[model samples]
Target: MKVVIYRVGQNQYATPVESIQSIERMLPIRPVPGAAAHVLGVANLRGSVIAVSDLRKVLNVEEQAFTPESRLLISNGNGYVVDEALDIADCADDAWEHVGEQKVWQRGDQLIVWEDLQA
Candidate 1:
């Protein structure tokens, strides 16, 4: 199925484009107590409180300044946040080949796999 590809750390991940709500510019976040390090904070989206996380930090990626293109991809059902939502690409089922040696945590059908930049 065609999916939206995005970068986290040095890896690329694709999610079905239909699952994406909207990509919004980085909004001001209020700090939360006792939250994880990766959890940057929370922002009020419309009237709801949406928790924000630095996708780069969560994936142990190098930090960079938020550019005009920097966005927050709100996924339906999942409360997770994405760093910069990259372009949407077409990825068939056969295209998803397993890359050995690297371990990733999968939630439901979402395979959080790491892609080698060198390959």
Candidate 2:
């Protein structure tokens, strides 16, 4: 299966390309009052407002620096934070393992974890 690999903190993850609505650059987030700590804020995608969140907290990874590689993975009208949008990967079917609500696979030297947006 073809997947889009990305980083959230120091770890790399992958999700089926078809699963996401779009991949966009880091967007300006407006703080939301009384929101969760992991809730970065909301962003205006074109004209629609979408909630943005940090995946690092959910994955329990230490926060990392953001660079030009940083991007937002849009799904279900939400924009998820990613340290970097790596590349497209072609992984074997047997290489994937269903873990919780996510799918994990090996990509070269590291493991690429897939986060389920619907969960």
TM-score of each: 0.71, 0.87
Q: Give the top-scoring candidate (TM-score).
A: 2
Report the alpha-carbon TM-score of model 2 versus the true structure: 0.87
**For model 1, how does the per-residue alpha-carbon lDDT over 66-86 read when each residue is reduced to its tens digit?**
766667777652234555567
Best by lDDT: 2
lDDT for each residue of candidate 2 in 1-119, tens digit (9 for 90 to 100): 78888888767888787788999999889999999988889999999999999888768888776678889999889988888888887878799888887777866689778777656
Candidate 2 wrong stretches, greater than 4 Å: 98-103
For model 1, the superposed segments whose C-alpha errors exceed 4 Å read: 9-11, 77-83, 101-119
Worst 10 residues of 2 by lDDT: 110-119
Q: Given candidate 2, what's the lDDT at residue 11? A: 75
Candidate 1 lDDT for residue 67: 67
Q: What Cα-based lDDT does every candidate model obtain?
A: 0.64, 0.84
